[model samples]
Target: MIGKFLNRINELSMLRDNWNYEGAKPIHATVCRQAKALVVRLSENILKSLVVFPDVDGTLLFDVRSDNSHSTIFVCDNFFSYILKKKSGNNEVFSGCSWNKDSDVNAMISKIEDSLS
Candidate 1:
């Protein structure tokens, strides 16, 4: 599962780079929405597989910020339950979340990287 997530992430990153090389001004909203959904879906699955309690209730929200230089993916549950942020050229950061469990956060990060293989 983690492998799949990383593959998708890599694919998107490459796509974005290609678009930039082509001198594209901005990415389309639909594409962004789709990408955000995929991230949320994969995150949710990771959370579930870990048996993390208070499972997400299908209320994941994505806060995307991007400019000519960089992009960010912020995922959170409704009511700010949990927030995960991944920025261009940086590792994923767990800003805050309702879980607030260090072990869970560490495990999640590990899982995400595990998929990279």
Candidate 2:
């Protein structure tokens, strides 16, 4: 699974500018590096629930879904934003956060993991 994740991320690097046919930016190198590092750190359970994709803006997205909830982490050059939706229809958003801040990222990951569990 980790191999699959790494392969998908690496494949993003092959995308050229305007790959979306709408003047979309190519995948940013920093975003891909950060995303690969993140994927390596994630637990197997979380990885199993994850979906990785790139946005037209050259950012990376990690989407995790469970039967009762969904969470998304949007990764930019040096930071990330998270959105979480619960079974009860509650939505929470956290934006303009740095990925270098381990505490913030860890807390978000833990919350998502716990909710999914």
Candidate 3:
């Protein structure tokens, strides 16, 4: 279902301003591109329960939940932020920028894998 996630991300881009009935901004094109890139980097296992959507602030949001954990990754124009909640009640929260770099993408991939495990 990675395809499903990607499709949803694309759908989110069609949302208009105030789509949420609360004056929310539409999803930014840059944010959608960044989100799709991140999704493409995900492993199938981590993609299993992943859901992609947009936030009111024009960023993309990715959420994945396993039996013992839950995580969220927010994608903006050139950066990403994530919150990983572990089964043991510990949480990992961080943000990184610079989508033009391979290292940043790799770091996000690694963090996502850890969150899902």
Candidate 2 — number of clashing residue pairs?
0
Per-residue lDDT tens digits for candidate 1, residues 1-117, read 545544443444334323545444333334344344444444443433321111122222333222311112233332122333343444445444333454654554453544433
Better of 2 and 3 by lDDT: 2
RMSD, each candidate, Å? 15.7, 1.0, 1.4
Taking the tens digit of each residue's C-alpha lDDT, what string does model 2 give over 24-89? 798899999888888887888889999988799999899999998899999899888999999888
- Candidate 3 lDDT, tens digit per residue, 1-117? 767878998899999999999999999999988888788888998898788877999988888889878888888897777888888888888777568888877886787687666
Q: Lowest summed-lDDT stretch of 10 residues in model 3?
A: 108-117
Candidate 3: C-alpha RMSD to true structure equals: 1.4
**Alpha-carbon local distance difference test for all models:** 0.37, 0.88, 0.84
From the highest lDDT down, the ranking of the candidates is 2, 3, 1
Candidate 3 lDDT at 4 equals 85
Q: What range of 10 consecutive residues in model 2 has the weakest lDDT sum?
A: 108-117
Q: What is the lDDT of residue 9 in candidate 3?
A: 88
